[model samples]
Target chain A: MHLSEPYLSRRALLSSVTGGTLLLTLGACISGGQEPSPTGPDPIEPVLAASVYLADRYTAAMAAVPDLADRLTPLRDAHQAHITALTRELGTVDDGILPSGRPPAVAPAGSESTPAATASSGNAAAPEVTASPVPLPAERPAILADLQGLERSGRQQAAALCLAGSRYRAALLGSIAAARASHAEVLT
Target chain B: MTTGDEQLAEALRAEHAAIFGYGAIGAKLDKATAQFALQAEEEHRERRDALLLRLSQRGGTPPAADPVYTLPVAVTDQASALQLAVTIEERVAARWRSVLPQAAGEDRTMALDALIGSAVLATQARRHAGISPATVPFPGAPA
Candidate 1:
């Protein structure tokens, strides 16, 4: 959808306004920060996955139009920086819940995947995982269109994520969304 | 006013400033750059009007625009004028971004759209100014 359109219709807004008022009143009655919530899946995981996907797309674009490497490399680098920032923000998700969620290949009790081994072998690095590059488009127009679509999708996802519970997460997501929108504009 | 309303009001104010700021910048630039500035100014004006209606419909009175604003940088030549345009767009983008989390549904959507619009405009301004790597890595975030 074009960015200018309102997310909800006027009728929906009216109804939501009433419901939101009640919710706000109810929310005020409860003391803030009194609940100790359990950590769920890292919300950044999906965003990180999206960043990787975007980076892979950039790589594919580079391969498809090597001459455009000068342009594509910076875009890819931005996604890489996003991955690093998001990972750092997440602060090592329970190894049990890797971003991929594929359950670290059934390692033995003393293996690297095991907490005991990880603790004993201080400074031991995790195995590096790589994403497969995307396939090439048949022509330059197709490639630009593909990248443009990917940028648009990334922008939408990041905008939705901008309302995340954590302020820092929301800020990061907003920045990514803005960056993606600029990318789309550049492509155009 | 609620936090969201206050933030939205602030965004409206920024839009008012941007709409005014473009008038100064547009005069100093070449035909092409002036065209971009005119288009961007119109967009900001449209956004401002929309935000005013939204605020009023919510029973919140929108802030009045100041007659003038002090530019972060002076606009003398075409180069400086372009820089001023970039600054205005970036400031407007930041204002819209601050409203996002506090807003919901349509308000949130409007904030996101405005933020993105300002960001793209800022990048365009930078490109027109012949800046290298025209787009910032993070448009609205504090550096």
Candidate 2:
């Protein structure tokens, strides 16, 4: 059988060859396998860093209230994904998961749960280093309030950044802003 | 019309559709849910009017709202109404997302505001519908 003689066979063969090469090229491009550029710090770093900080808050909240883990985990996971996506957009590393040294603060008496303030590590370049201040909300209500506030501020910051970004970058930032706004609603 | 004005017009169109959808949704919902729908509808109307005026000032003809919109799902009960509300917000968010690329300065800020509002409303509606997680990782991005 002369397989190449059939029009279907020829098209299929060509498509397979080109498709495989295209997939590999796209994968390489997405994975950022090339040498790093020597440009100044990425403009998106601050937003990514803020996401990392929010993720840390979730971690602290979960630690304080183990019972709320099921609810808080998903929120934390979303922020982690945000950090990953934003950092990847800048072709940077995804080391946004650093742990805080402080212990989780227990909810104060009379309150549903006690949450410590968000602690800034004071690194202007990498704001994600700001730890969660060991703020842990031991109850569902407290957790919701804490997360709602954090998400609100995060949404505002991300939206501000989106205004000045390029199209693709702005789209991503806008999505991040939208996600945070939803987070606030969900927490509420 | 400039690109930004055109994008704003697109967003305005979505708001018009949302206003129509919310009217149907509010009718089928309880007092609280219906109130949410009404507020959302009013918000869309406000934005729509503002955009229309802005387009007019720029000498761009604002696209007319569709006489009718087909809902994605039948909103027969509260659950369905909630779902429809969520869908409307998500659709509006997608439109605002498109506007961001062409917008600048205050226009960009407005688009971001609209996107954020829709996203929050979508989540709120999903929460009312008893959807798990209650939040998506990315809102207004195409799957």
Candidate 3:
């Protein structure tokens, strides 16, 4: 549904009213010695896992849709870039390392089984681990939706990572957020 | 209710809802749209799993998904679907905001960035839907 005109106007009015105050509050919050939280092991590992997962999915998508291969190639490249960047950052951090609790069971590519079957096999290896589903759609709209979702998810994970990391990590996450924001705009 | 675990549960709940919402979103669009839906669904799945892992690591049982969730509005068309997406992102952003107080350091920055990113995505969705005031005044303001 469309935003009601009144609602839009009210939002604008409210923003105008509180804009300065919010900025000042944020500034104070930043200036105050409220040092950012340390990166905890529980949070960082999943984000890294997600980055790797997306990169793999993108590779699969590119292979499945040769027609959109040229278009999607850059997107896949971008995800790989993110994976590298996040891995490096995580390497430097002290907390939030995913426990060697269990290795993620990844199936061999192009095996006799269907992608879904392979994914299921992998899942069986690590019963507690849940991953994004395999067997994606090859259509452009479907692909775009998946990409947007991936970017949005990445933004969330990056935000979490930023919170758990240091100033450098936060800045890195902010940049990632900017990229995801752009992805949302272009993917649509 | 505002404990770290509780707040994380809420965030995971929102992720579950968003994942479910993508099903409807995927149905309304063509192949191009399906791609976006597929990716979004995967992302939600990953986030949900991560949240579950986090809860388990803390010795808490992960929350289960609700049998159904109430959408803010019907999503019969592209515009409406995007609106729902904007709403989902905003809600998740709110959860991040709540978690910020309880979190420090990297977690705090991450939450702030997530909030900002959600706000940006919501604004983009609005603009794509041809809505006026394309930019939301506040990205993660309540409701």
Candidate 4:
């Protein structure tokens, strides 16, 4: 039985045949298989790097307080998952993982000179402290709240990263974003 | 109303909401967690600023944030609060996807990545909650 070219009209068939030949010629013209373009650092790399640093902090916390290990293990794993997914997509990873080299001495909420200082330094300045810097809260509720907040922040950063890297690596960024969102929920 | 500018405006709105949500989430967190939340908030602020700059560069006015944003639910417990956070990120991802059609190359890639990342995060959260369908079928692709 002969199959009819219903899908491919005469003009379409001619174009396809021509296209195929052109593709073959083009392939032969190039010596090596199309070399992957030298990709620059993806915009989302910094955020993923930050997440890895945060994951390390969580791991440290878990180690320090064995009781919190169960609570933080999955979160830590998720961050690791994100780093893997992002790095794989970017084809490179940044050496630095921390979100800025040094931790803030104080919060940015109640600082007078902090804005000016940050502007001059071109980095976030440590804000003044009105509230006392007590030790980490002991209560479960307080601790959970903190964890939830941290996860939310991580999710936001991931989301931004996804936005920044969506076009070149949709699948990778999507996976990372989803993981961050999941972390937020788990922390809550 | 649904011009490129409008799409950008919607994205900016999502950024504002995210920044505000981080504040609520930060309140209950510990030192390390609080620091992360604060940094995330700052990042969103920076992105919002960049959006405004882009808009102005194109001779368009950037959208303003509302006086207050309404939360999907009260963040009374960690579980509920995290659920809300997940939802917010997903919503933002959806909005970014909308803007993707108009964007190209790097910008488009950025939007796609953001959407996917948000979806992955949401899935992780769901699994933590012991829920089925932890990850969505396609996090940032067209529905």
User: Tens digits of per-residue lDDT for model 4 on A21-83?
Assistant: 322232232222222344423354444444544454455466556797766666665565555
Q: What's the alpha carbon RMSD for model 2?
A: 15.8
Query: In candidate 1, which residue pairs get closer than 3 Å at backbone N, Cα or C atoms, i.e. clash?
Result: none
Instruction: Rank candidates by DockQ, best first.
Output: 2, 1, 4, 3
Worst 10 residues of 1 chain A by lDDT: A2-11
| Fnat score for model 3 | 0.13
Off by over 4 Å in 1: A1-40, A63-66, A93-133, A138-141, A163-168
Question: Per-residue lDDT tens digits of candidate 2, residues A98-175?
Answer: 122211122221122211122222122213222213334567687668667767766766766676556667788899
Candidate order by lDDT, highest to lowest?
A: 2, 1, 3, 4
Off by over 4 Å in 3: A1-188
Across B1-143, the per-residue lDDT of candidate 4 in tens digits comes to 33756777778889888878866776665564455456656666776787778778778778788878888868876566566666776777788767765565455555555555555545644554455546543354444
What's each prediction's clash count? 0, 2, 39, 45
Which of candidates 1 and 4 is the stronger one according to DockQ? 1
Candidates in order, TM-scores: namely 0.72, 0.75, 0.44, 0.42
lDDT of 3 by residue, A1-188 (tens): 12122222222232232222322332233342223335323233344444445555666777777676655555555554554555455453232122211112232322323222233333333321223234466686887787676666555555545554544444445545445555555556
What order do you get sorting by TM-score, best first?
A: 2, 1, 3, 4
DockQ of each: 0.35, 0.62, 0.07, 0.14
Question: What CA RMSD would candidate 1 show?
Answer: 12.3
* lDDT for each residue of candidate 2 in B1-143, tens digit (9 for 90 to 100): 78888789889889988988987887788887777777788888888888888889888789998999888989789999899998899899999998888887778888888888888888878877888878888888997
lDDT, residue A89, candidate 4: 53
Encode model 1's per-residue lDDT on A59-174: one tens digit a residue: 66787678988777777767766755665565543432232322222333223543222322332221111111234578988788777776776676666566434554555677
